[model samples]
Target: MRRYPSLVMLMLACSVAVTACKPAPQAMPVDPEPAAPATTAAAATPAPVPARNECPYPKFDAFLKHFGNEITLQEKATADPLLDSHIDAEAEPEPRKVESRLALADVEWPVMPDPAALAGQGRELQVNTLADGQRQVQIRTPDSSDQQTYTFAQAPCWTLVKREDESI
Candidate 1:
């Protein structure tokens, strides 16, 4: 009986020792290329183009006509008045919230009309000329009550047109 207990204890000790003495698994090799010093000259990055100050003066009537078609299609597909109401209810009354939620409510991403089609329509496509000569175009929906302002070189063009204003 004494010998049996000692043999079991010795077996346990041997197993523990074998496990403890086992060598740690080697780590997989990694590529050293990323750490290598760059030998070639650093490529020169191009300077960023400054934003244009003027809006593109597109043919407003033609642009609106094209935009209207796109808006109509979009409205037919996913203009959920119920969803709009829910969004409005959850939205904060802040100006940014109103602007973001309502800005596109009435407009869709306008399709770029072909240059030839625009020419056939007898409409000139001029982008809003920024002070820096970059052209931009903005679309305002009829529900927008906020005054939209565009600035060129810190100069402001206030009271351009209201959403209800048909002058565009």
Candidate 2:
């Protein structure tokens, strides 16, 4: 009876040791994680949009009317049109004299002459949208007048781009 008890205890210990040394059963196969929700076309691609809107000028006169009018100039924020770039590439170029009525629109401007209200001074201001899609405003003062041409190609605002004294 004593030997039978010892034999039973040895067998139980051997079985427990064998089970502990055995590798854990492999995990059962599962559905491939739902295929990660397929990437939609909209999610993968970006929307196409134009960089800038077309220039909005019905008539050049109406557009430049903002230049001579005090209230109009204030509403536009920019007294004179922005100069995107200069036409002449000279290192030291002569100053382009734009008229006072229009020049005074930019009060703090130092280089340009913003004299007294000269709209009543009888200066012929001509604005035209060129065939190349730039709005050209020409200001012709008496004989000493310079060829100062402005362009508004980038936006609705005018830009003084070209100037050559006595060219016109």
Per lDDT, the best of the predicted structures is: 2
TM-scores of the candidates are 0.27, 0.35
Candidate 1 lDDT tens digits, 1-168: 576998889899999999888866664346656544443323345555544333222334343344434634333322222121112334355312222223345543432333335545544433366676433333233444322222112112111121211121
Cα deviation in Å at residue 32, candidate 2?
36
Collision count of model 1: 16
Clashes of each: 16, 0
Candidate 1 deviant stretches above 4 angstroms: 1-13, 22-102, 109-114, 136-168
Query: Which residue pairs clash within candidate 2?
Result: none
What lDDT, from 0 to 1, does candidate 2 have? Answer: 0.47
| Residue-pair clash count for candidate 2 | 0
For model 2, how does the per-residue alpha-carbon lDDT over 64-120 read when each residue is reduced to its tens digit? 554444443433434343333333424356534333233434434332222234356
Query: Hey, what RMSD does candidate 2 come out at?
Result: 11.4
Best by TM-score: 2
In the order shown, the candidates' Cα RMSDs to the true structure are 14.3, 11.4
